[model samples]
Target: MGESEQKVAKEPTEETAEVTGATVATEVSALPAEAPAVLPKTPPKGSKSYELIFLVDAALPKEELDALIAKVQGIIEQREGIVENVRVSDVRRLAYEIKKRTHGVYVVVNFFLLPSQIAELERLLRLDERVLRHMVICTRSS
Candidate 1:
């Protein structure tokens, strides 16, 4: 391009001006040197309520399913978790196939557990062949 075209291209437009203004404001209003750094707030040190939902292979026998549920309960209890409820739904057809299976047995577990132990529990579930899919969500009011 010519020198004039290059100069025009380099000129700051309204968008660039606004961006520069914001950047300047952000830099100037940053925390003062003497101010303490901010930290994230954490919940009190106690068990947190959570609901765990998982899908198991539908083809498993009733005895096998019971054993799987017992194994899950054991994991939670081993991690200082308290199981409040354990519900199992009948084997039903799935919307889409998983692991070449057309149906799954749905199980929902409500419990109080430490947040730190959730990862380990999920890891165990993931490694179990009986489990097809699983989800864990907080049930705390806050």
Candidate 2:
């Protein structure tokens, strides 16, 4: 040991992890770098959330129902959202007679939709007088 001897030590203040891209710094006894944080969990587009169910009038003929369903499917597709499932319950009976027909067709569809697009769908259904009654229900969230 003499005047020519020298020692080097790391000062521990705060060091950030470059890999994580975060402003927060971490303390370590050695290199003292924070561990890279993993990406926040995000629900996939096909998540079971955003469950939506809409009931269409059964008064319209089978062809009309098919057409409307196709159009609606297109709209939903354009939104880039996945359709989990669709159920159509066209019960051949109505609370009252419709168009002098004692039996009315009932249709039920379940699909996901954006909040903004809901208004547009409602408008479309309203334009069609053939629908006796319609109901829209959201079952889940994403």
What Cα-based lDDT does every candidate model obtain?
0.78, 0.56
Best by TM-score: 1
Residues 76-105, candidate 2, lDDT per residue (tens digit)? 667655555554654566567655667654
The number of clashing residue pairs in model 2 is 2
Task: Tell me the lDDT of model 1 at 132.
Answer: 92
In TM-score terms, candidate 2 sits at 0.51
Clashes of 1: 0
Candidate 1 C-alpha lDDT tens digits along 81-128? 788778888779999999999998899998888888999999999999
Go through the candidates in order and give the clash count of each: 0, 2
TM-score of 1: 0.67
